[model samples]
Target: MIIRREHAGDRPEILAVVKAAFPEPVEAKLLRELFASREYIPELSLVAESDRGEILGHVITTRGWIGAEKSLGLGPIAVQPEYQNQGVGSALMNATIEQANKMGESTLVLLGSTDYYPRFGFVPADSMGITSPDPSWGSHFMALPLAAHKPGLHGQFKYSEPFNAL
Candidate 1:
């Protein structure tokens, strides 16, 4: 399988993959809103495709902020059900992280499973003095410092408006 940046033509298939990956339509709906928002960072949206050109997974990172410091927000990572344990999601995630590093993003935050994201260097946001807008997220809110760690970076983390609506 090949991991690459998502292209315009991949939208419909991406949507299908996302929708099929989750039990609810919420994630798919959030993806659509995110793509249309100014916070969307095209370079950080990626797909895992098979040799036959079928997209197997998708991941995206968008503009976010930790107080005044800019950050990246990762979310809605989805893999087609058949491809879940086949490493498609991992490939897409690795590609997104690599691209974010190359683009000079200092950090990335996400609301996800602690068990799943720790391998990617994510830790509880509270560890860095960062709090999520939604209080209920608690420990599920994670952050990873991509560049050199900044001890001074601490504050409320804000995702794009579309996320608030979700």
Candidate 2:
């Protein structure tokens, strides 16, 4: 398996995987909105592929705010039904995360399963004094400060307009 930046041509396959991974329309709709929005940075989007060139999973990073501070947000990481639990999600995540670090991002935020995210270094957003616009999420919203010595961000996150479209 391999992980790499997704090209424009890969959108269809990426969406297919999202549909298979999550049957709900919400995640798929979010994917489309993010792709069409100005906040979408192609370089930060990634996919997992097999050695045979089959697209197996995807992950997207988009512009989001922590209070007034700007940072990246990871979401909608999906693997095809047949590929679930095969580390495809992890591969895509590690790749995009490494890229964000290389690009000097201050942090990465996510809203994910509380049980799954900690393996990737995510701590409860509330613990970091970070809050999301939706209070119902409680501890499910999370953040990981990427840069050492970087002052922590503490404020309500403003997700990109595309997120609102969902």
Candidate 3:
């Protein structure tokens, strides 16, 4: 399998993979909204494709803010149920992180599994002075500072508008 940027044609398959990966429909709905959102960063939306051309997983990062400063919010990453534990999700994540760094992004934040994300260098956002929009998120709210990260980036993290709508 290989990781690559998502294309417009991949939407349907991507949504299928996301829906199959999670029990709730909220994530799939969010993904649809993100695609049309102004905050959408095409380069940061990626897919993991099987050798046979099946989309095995998907991930997206959108424009977010830390106080008034620009940042990124990652979410709704999903690997097909059959693809779980096979590194498809990890590949998509590494590709997104690498691409974001190339774009000079400061940090990538997400609310995710404490066990799964730390391997990619993510830590509690509060540890870096970045507060979550929902304080109850606590440690599940994490951040991974990129190569362009700066010490001054701190304050309430506001996700893209669609996220606010949710």
Candidate 4:
């Protein structure tokens, strides 16, 4: 298996993997909107491919804001049903984090499984002074401070505009 940045030609396969990973179409629909939104960061969109060149999973982090400071919003990371628990999601996540660090990003935030994301060094957002757009998310809303993280980077997190429509 291989992990790499997503290409324009990978759209169909990415969407298919996302749709198959979830029971509802909400995530897939959100991905479509993110792709067309200005907040879409091409470099942050990544995919995991099998040795046979089949797409196995997908992950994306779009431009967002932490108060007035720039940040990243990670989401819709999905692996095909058969690919779950096989480290595909982990590979995509590690790649995303490495790339974000390479790009000098401050932080990456997301609403994800507490069990899974913690393994990636994600901690409760509020603990880092970052508040979720929805208070109801509580601890599930997490943040991973990157190599460029600073002590003063905190405030209400505002996800990309397309996320507001959800």
TM-score of each: 0.96, 0.95, 0.98, 0.98
Lowest summed-lDDT stretch of 10 residues in model 3?
82-91
13-51: candidate 4 lDDT, tens digit per residue: 999999999999999999999999999998999999888
- Which scores better on TM-score, 2 or 4? 4
Off by over 4 Å in 3: none
Q: Candidate 4 — which residues are off by over 4 angstroms?
A: none
Deviation in angstroms for 84 in model 3?
A: 0.5
- On lDDT, the leading prediction is 4
lDDT of each: 0.89, 0.85, 0.94, 0.95
Per-residue accuracy of model 1 over 15-107 as CA lDDT, tens digit each:
999999999999999999999999999898888889999999999888999888888899889999987887777777788878888998888
Model 2, span 42-136: residue lDDT tens: 88888888889999999999998887788778888899889888788877878877888888888888989988888889888888888877899
* lDDT of candidate 3 over 1-166, digit per residue (tens): 9888899899999999999998999999999999999999989999998899999999999999999899999998999998799888889889999999999999999999999999999999999999999989989999999999998888999999989977
Residue-level lDDT for 34 in candidate 2: 92
Per-candidate total of colliding backbone pairs: 0, 0, 0, 0
